[model samples]
Target chain A: MEVAYLGPIGSFSYRAVKLAFPDAKLTPVATLVDVIEAYEEGRVDLALVPIENSIEGPVNLTIDQLFHQSSAHVVAEIVLPIVQNLLVVDAKRAPEKIFSHPQALAQTREYLSEHFPQASSVPVASTALAAEIVQQHPTLAYAAVANLDAADFYGLVPLAKGIQDVAQNNTRFWVLGEKQPHIALPSTAQKVTLALTLPENLPGALHKAISTFAWRGIDMTKIESRPLKTVLGQYFFIIDLVSNDNIKYACKEMESLGITVRNLGKYCIYEGEK
Target chain B: MEVAYLGPIGSFSYRAVKLAFPDAKLTPVATLVDVIEAYEEGRVDLALVPIENSIEGPVNLTIDQLFHQSSAHVVAEIVLPIVQNLLVVDAKRAPEKIFSHPQALAQTREYLSEHFPQASSVPVASTALAAEIVQQHPTLAYAAVANLDAADFYGLVPLAKGIQDVAQNNTRFWVLGEKQPHIALPSTAQKVTLALTLPENLPGALHKAISTFAWRGIDMTKIESRPLKTVLGQYFFIIDLVSNDNIKYACKEMESLGITVRNLGKYCIYEGEK
Candidate 1:
């Protein structure tokens, strides 16, 4: 199957896709929107996009795009441990300029400030692009903050490993496909994600919506709010629940309360090596 | 009093600060972090930062910074009606490149794609800076998506107004001060924001936390989750509640459940003209 992912190749998303779909034909797309669009337009059978980071929280662009466009269902989850390494062409030289995706730069902010106090941190499109840029500019004292795969792919040396501020940094990626995976049988699926729209002008609307899961003794892994974009205060809540029989009932209860419930996915987690 | 805000003089934060604290001495900082740091260091009495937008949900940088570094309280909220106008140096020719901050570009994505599909969208630091750049390169067919104030400040003519995808585009700014505003009294405050950290390894921990509000009949205006940065699954929930006497009791109940609660602010909302 052909798969689309945000890449210049050797990105964290690339690593995730490679781990999850090892034999798939990988098509490197420039942006997150393009990845989803490729799948929606049937350019690829599936697409991989980073949905959340342990350090950076939700990937807003991915979530926003999913909310606004695309009818694709998440078929799989890939949890990859993120290690932001300092890569360079010459290890002995102190870099005067550092390049990275803004998220990586933020993750390594403390480390960068402590080590490369004088270096200017430039925000590029992606970590892989940062690696490519640093590799292309060998004459300049430029370093890149990227993953091991990026360093390997771009032939850059890892000047320092795990330069991120936190040791437990991990990113969760979603595999989006037009067709729901047959593996989503209740016996196999471990998680269920739903987008909930609460009825308007109702007092305690969100509270009542959460009550459906709470009273049913269901365990929710996450509940996040995104703007509905129609008004200032209205929102759409994206919820994740531990897969259980009660999820079906809870969704029904939510719908009974006039909350529009859209089942985004019921998927199993695939953890990549640390 | 002096105020620090993210700016190049005509940014949205600048406009928010100008509207909120009309006579204050304004210091334009380079980034959101700098705006907060300036206030924390006593260089400025207060700082104005964009916390949320109607179209773009929360401002991650501002929210993350507030959760991690600042001890400052949100003294007040300023809701400003955002109008993304297409500013041009010369309107006779079609633009080859369009410039705006990424958020603005995203807000105007549909509009841009429908109108200027041939033009490349360039992500700049801020919409005001985009306006300035377009003004500086007057000979080129360049357009900027920015506010009317920026166009006025940069002397660019408005090619189009309200080019955002949605008609109800509004941004909420927070005024952060080291000391709590005397106006925070229950009698005057309309909202209270709290950052809650749920106890570890507890089933339905989030639900139990929300129960504090549900049982007490309190109304919540917003609920958003941010990663605690320690692990992949752990999170910190930021909640906004309608100001009421029961807020104190709710905090006690949350603490009783072993949840760490930090009161970000109890303040009033100020709405800017549409």
Candidate 2:
């Protein structure tokens, strides 16, 4: 199997991909768009992308592209507890510039403000990319907020560990593939993901749509609303429901109400070590 | 009146603030957190912040800081049609780098990928800051994705205009203050924004909460799920409802179902010229 992920290598997505597909050949791409493109263009068997973080909410780029630009199905999920660390080439030197992916920068905002109040923070494409930049600019007083894996991979020193604002900073990554798994899914399979587009200007369309599963005793783990990208007030709901035999019936009932339901995937979730 | 906004000036938020309070004394701040802090600490009479965008959905930093850190109420809103432009110090020079706020960068991602595939895009604190950086470094081949206001403010040439991915790229900015408007709101006051926290692990809690307003014929203009920041799969719904007399009753009914609803504010909306 071949797997593609957003990376310069040593990113959280790379870690998740490694844990999920230990034997697969890994292809690291530069951006989330590239990761999806690699899967869509048949360059890789699967693509792993971060969908949400406990601290930052949903990754809008991934959600927007997943629903609007691609038709791939999510085959698996990995929940990784993110522990951001400050990496540097020379730990003794006080850094004047800090860098990381925007989300990582946000996760460590409080720490940065409290400690390095005068340092300038820069956002990059990925945390590992920040590490690479910091590694290459050894003479500059620069630091990166990334995972320990990045520090190890780039031979940078971890000046500080677990600098995220919150203690439970978990990020969820989805492995996207071209086809669904067989009907006899593993017993661990517990969640079904659906993207629902409700008809416009309807008062109770969203309520009615959720009721279909609610009335059936199905538990919804999450419900996120993203813009349909057409207008300001218009949105489509991305829902995560406990996998059940009655999901199809609920989807059918929703369809009858003029709600366009797209089954993105039904897959099991695995927890990654912190 | 004194107003604080996220700016070095010439930002979209600055434009919205100028339109909303043309006569007020404006105080430009560096970050969204500083804007809220200025309001909370009584440094400004009102603080203007970007709440949501048509293409990017909700502004997570603003939402999180508003609900979690402060108790201010949203007093008014301004919807501005965003038209991103490529700003350059030298129009004849081919740009090797692009810079903008992360939101602006994402908004113009498609345009950048199509027009300048080889240019490196840098994310900055604000679009105005990007224009400032580009202005100060005339020797470097750098461009900024910002509004016409920014380009004019920084004396930069507009290499391209209306370069956003979508035409309907509107952003909603909220003016937050300490007190409720004297109870006699204007006729244009049409929206009430609420943040609701549903009790843990309860099936249909969200459905039940929405149904309170839905069954009463109240139209919810928007519903966005944001992380509660406590754990994975937990969320708080930020709901925008069309202002109505029955909204209080709906809140009572939701409270009866054990939902914790925080009334952020009920405010009128204004539109800025494109």
lDDT of 1 at B199: 85
TM-score (chain B) of candidate 2: 0.85
Give me candidate 1's interface root-mean-square deviation. 4.0
Query: TM-scores across all candidates?
Result: 0.87, 0.88
* lDDT to native, each model: 0.80, 0.82
Worst 10 residues of 1 chain A by lDDT: A180-189
Q: Write the per-residue lDDT of candidate 2 for residues A1-274, one digit (tens) a residue.
A: 7889876678887777777777788898766777899999999888989886522223767888899999999988788888999999999998899988666787788999899999999866568778999999999999999998899999999999999887876678888986643221123446999999999855589888989988998888777787787766788889989899999999999898889999999888777774
Q: Give the alpha carbon lDDT tens digit for every residue of B1-274 in model 2.
A: 7999877678888777777777789899766787899999998898989876522223866898899899999988788888899999999998999988666787788899899999998866567778988999999999999888888899999999999887876687888986543221223447999999999856689889988988899987677777787766678989999999999999999888889989999888877774
Question: What are the per-model DockQ values?
Answer: 0.39, 0.39
Q: Which DockQ-derived CAPRI band holds candidate 1? A: acceptable
Fnat, 2 decimals, each candidate: 0.39, 0.29
